[model samples]
Target: MRPLTPGDVRIAACREGDLVALDRHLPSPSHPRRYTRQLAGLGTLLVAWDGGQPVGHCEVRWDGCAAAEVRGVVGDCPEVNGLFVWPESLRRHGIGTALITTAEDLVRDRSGPRIGLGVKDGNTRAAALYVRLGYRPAVPRYLDRWSYVDQDGRMHDNADPCAFLVKELG
Candidate 1:
């Protein structure tokens, strides 16, 4: 396989037609519902593609922060949530960073002055990445709780201690 670079990735909001492939590469069939949400003007599923492969994704909740503690703190600024790059071998090759910066650009294009995201407390690596990207602590730690069903039909209910972080776009 050819080595991947930042230049090799193309990031864009998940379109109606991208749902099928997204359902395949992404964790679950949630992309379809996410696409419906996108169409309803709620949030967007931004997908990062490397050539023909869907390599990463991050949801931009344009309405406001998804975390309860950070919600009203940043007004209506978009939130970058659930950023992921598949295949452990592909990490640190700029794909995750590209997804984040692209999300920022998209929000900045809409005149958004800031953005926010929640990081699970134990996820030091992700927190470091957010800090390097200029996000700072915004709210006191809170419970990060959610549930999801995987492609295999298993349901997961998770709750974690997390912190909300925000960054001003320059």
Candidate 2:
């Protein structure tokens, strides 16, 4: 998609009704209802919308990683996890940046010392984005604590090598 200007998209905290409104706009090959339900109970889920279509979405985990095993991976750092930009065509247009910015704002307002996030070891593109935004790797070089539910309602488990990154956000 063409680069989107600030006027072309708006980022806001997702409301309860957005779960249904965004049901059809989720990334392909994924079940919208499952994603909607997951975000519904997770920490704040933010959405980037172009009028009525959701182009991107992300979640902030106040307590820790959703997985119980990695709860203190960041040691009290609020995590900006589950970042996704749908329709592939809508990426590289600053939507992800805007979403992260909003997340930082949310964290800062809560007086968090810093924000944390994890990137798959193989996802160099996403790692670069986090670096550009000033996040640096934390200890625990590689973690297998990443897990999530898939579209089919199946609990999938993966020990994908992941690195935890953190950025101080006074």
Candidate 3:
């Protein structure tokens, strides 16, 4: 039940554990290996842990140009590559907001003015959370089946259309 900073002892020592937690939460193509690469490249990751167990996590990536696309929305922006809270801890309180606040802080320091992310269209709860945190729908409608291939040669068609969401950092 505490905020875990990047350099803090708990975070430093639990990178792998955090990765496992992330793997469990996000879907394929958004798996741990991909997440690790993205996080390393993006330069910012925040996690909330309870007694050394990662309970929530969020990450943002600099998509090279001022304009970036996330979940199908394109614009001059940084992307919220991932945000997940463990299902068991969903009702515990404050963890999701805390993780998001940390991400905003990181983006602010980088002088980023806007951030974006994609959520499955049917996932109203997650969308609501993002909206509550200031994200607004940037896309007119959800985009269809984005394809992703995993290391195992399994192809995944993200059947659930996704809606793009954006938040102004400034």
Candidate 4:
């Protein structure tokens, strides 16, 4: 597949009917209903669309980082959480970057001081992408916790030993 520039993807906050489409496009744990925090004003789920097809997604947590250590150390600010690109699109295809840039834009529009994201310790590729995008380590480590509901409607919780990264937005 050819590389996609950021412009190739259109990013927008997830709409009410988008849940079904996103869940069908993204992976299992990537179920859009799982992060429907937009309904509560906690955050907005940004979906990257390519010609009306959902290609990727990321949640802009306007409330703050959910990780305890990140909250305590990074303080309250928007957090770019749960970014995911469809495996078919893969990394470096610009989908992930578009999703992140959109998340940053969301925070920046809110006059947010900065944004934080948690990366699994061993995910060097993703961490490197964040670094290249101007994110730096906000905290050495943290427990990133999340849960998702499967198609069968079973709830699954997860916790990951992750490193927190933050980027100062203008």
lDDT of every predicted structure (CA atoms): 0.83, 0.75, 0.61, 0.80
RMSD to truth, every model: 2.0, 3.5, 5.2, 2.3
lDDT by residue (tens digit), candidate 3, 1-170:
45443333222222555666655553334555445655577445666665555666666666622222343345546666556667553543666777667767767887577777778767888888889889997874554455778789898775556777778887
- How do the residues 6-34 of candidate 2 rate in per-residue lDDT, one tens digit apiece? 56889987776777666778743333433
Q: How many Å off is the CA of 152 in candidate 2? A: 6.7
TM-score of each: 0.90, 0.81, 0.68, 0.87
Off by over 4 Å in 1: 150-156
Candidate 3 vs. true structure, TM-score: 0.68
Clashing residue pairs, candidate 3? 66-76, 67-75, 67-76
Error of 4 at 107 (Å): 1.0
Residue 166 local lDDT, model 3: 79
Backbone clash pairs for candidate 4 read: none
- Candidate 4: where are CA atoms >4 Å away? 1-3, 27-35, 148-157
Q: Residue-wise lDDT of candidate 4 within 1-170, one digit each (tens)?
A: 66667777888888878777876777555544445578788888888887778888888878788777778887777888778887664557788987888777777877566988889989999999999999999798888888777789999888889998889987
Better TM-score candidate (1, 2): 1
Candidates 3 and 4, the one with greater lDDT:
4
Ranking by TM-score: 1, 4, 2, 3
The candidate scoring highest on lDDT is: 1
Candidate 1 lDDT, tens digit per residue, 46-80? 99998877889988887876556666566666888
